[model samples]
Target chain A: MTNAERKRPGRPPGPSDTRDRILAVARELFARNGIDKTSIRAIAAQADVDPALVHHYFGTKTQLFAAAIHIPIDPMDVIGPLKKVPVEDIGRTLPSLLLPLWDSEAGKGFIATLRSLLAGNDPSLVRSFLQEVIAKEVGSRVDDPPGSGRLRVQFVASQLVGVVMARYILELEPFKSLPVEQIVDTIAPNLQRYLTGELPGLS
Target chain B: MTNAERKRPGRPPGPSDTRDRILAVARELFARNGIDKTSIRAIAAQADVDPALVHHYFGTKTQLFAAAIHIPIDPMDVIGPLKKVPVEDIGRTLPSLLLPLWDSEAGKGFIATLRSLLAGNDPSLVRSFLQEVIAKEVGSRVDDPPGSGRLRVQFVASQLVGVVMARYILELEPFKSLPVEQIVDTIAPNLQRYLTGELPGLS
Candidate 1:
């Protein structure tokens, strides 16, 4: 420890403490008002810190949101590569990218957080993430009929969320232990259909 | 009110009381020991009722389990029809039957029970229901290539469970509001693929 710190115990909040306060406030506001409606400045004010401090600690609002939710990596890490890929390949590529991440040690936290969130019967945070973030990013690209984009993405979300539940939360046999590649290959076609296939109700 | 009943204000347990006690006991035992091992006699014994009374009240072990889980209808209500459906059409037929039930008034109770169960983080009951009851009835029918039945059913379960999460729990827009028939049509093909379609690493 620095001599100055060693000499003075019981000091005021440090960098980590300030960062944690910002995250707690961000989670509350985001859950209450959703991502679009909740602002960094609002979160900063709630945390009793400067907006600049919030940004410096967590980068951007989305990044802050990720941190608040306990996702180990930025969503852009996955969404960025997805932008470059052909729409036809998104079904395969999306799961290919995500399955590995979800299977990693970091994924345990995400899964645990999801379970707790669902258990609490409050899904606003997750819903906001899906609607505002995922739907906007992937949904816009696959909006084949223009207005059908969000529904299509939501369908995709249904399947993906199911996979998470079955594989992680429910922990069903064989499905839980199956190779990730096998799952990616199997669901890719179905997910592709949701993304691009003709449907009964959609235009 | 019957005259005999009106004469007494809090008499000994009535027939409905006996039934409720049996159901509560059944849920605990079934959740702890699973369907194959938990017996109607055991549940009756725990409830301090006769095995005959348990049978008379709930009809069968599976029926008791259905009531215990608040499923409203006997699982046989779905499973019986499924037994008649050709394996080739199960994917479409399965969702066609389930979507309506899930969207029904009775389904609300089941969904609420599920939410509370999940929130409590004790999925043993749900897991048991899926593994022993649904998997046995459906998996056995789809067990193509010798031993692949259970796994196939589980994969299908992942998707179906995901649909429940999306529609009821997360209540994702559009996906949540989509017509029963629309969802049935959209997911049928995918579910059918899981049942009978060629999958990687399965052979």
Candidate 2:
């Protein structure tokens, strides 16, 4: 296809479905400033589009934000397959379930988001993220016991967040350079424990 | 003293320090965009001061960040006496040492900074912060032995971060209104265990 004929977003002057570009700018601005501080004007200026176009595309800032930061993976698509897997192996199944996805397209985007979140300069985005992503999903999965599940959930998050912190954010020596599989194998046991192990301090 | 009598940081017609004003603006910007993304220009514009004056007072972004974020408590001074205290009492001593610091003038700023961090706005700030203010000092005090202080250190941080996430960043219901000391006391044992306990599977 000729460059001109190739599908591309219609530029500013009037409305166009420029949600993707708007989202990109929003992510960058939000990463740079924060959700609260990054205004429509800034995003419009950065994206070289009209601000009203952003409203038309995404509706509200929160909706725009949800689109901007949304993990590409549908939670249903991810967790759906595991429903049939026995709860006992849910421990082992958990990491295995997640690894492939994280190794793929949607997961890679999520990983980048995690990396940005680790280093991004916005608080509201991060807080909302922790609740939306980690706390809700990870925190809710506990079946091990009472407090045990909670501890397990927190530990699971800690391990994962720590790993992301070390590997992605800090770029620690071996971890930074390690293959994803290697890191997974090394950390999966901890993941399983948090997922299925007897959580300590539980009655 | 009259406002005019207050020391101005920069030359007129260029930029002014506007210390208190800068601090106020800096807090909002920093909280919104994190330490790095929030720039001198932004702070200047917000404070109605010249950006050059920020350079005159703070010298560099790093220094400015330190001035803006560093809690006044010298970890060395506080941790020094902690070393001399009995091992078993370290848990109790820890909260006493750290809680007051978190509640102090500088500590409040630091906590506010942390609240922003927990919210996920500034990953670099959190990383360096954990490295500089938290990990190094905290790691030095705790060890891996029977009474080694380090295990609980991790727990303390985890617990504290969780509390900050829920209480400050997420602004979840009851947690928001809970007294700090009460909250600290409630979590102290868990912190103690995580700080000092033989975390299963790790050791």
Best by TM-score: 1
Best by lDDT: 1
DockQ of 2: 0.06
Tens-place lDDT per residue, model 2, A1-203, is 23343254573333333556677789888757656677888898988888887887776665576567676644545455656666555555655666566556666566565544433244456555444444445546664464344445544554455554454444434335556565455455545655665433444
TM-score of each: 0.90, 0.46
Model 2 ranges off by over 4 Å? A1-67, A77-108, A111-167, A170-203, B1-69, B85-105, B111-141, B145-163, B172-203
Which 10 consecutive positions of candidate 1 chain B have the poorest summed lDDT?
Answer: B1-10
- Give the Cα error of residue B59 in candidate 1, in Å: 1.5
Give the Å shift of residue A84 in candidate 2.
6.2
Model 1 ranges off by over 4 Å: A1-11, B1-17
Give Cα distance to truth, residue A154, candidate 1, Å.
Answer: 0.8
Model 1 C-alpha lDDT per residue in residues A45-107, reported as the tens digit of each score: 898999999989889888898898889888899999999999999999999999999999989
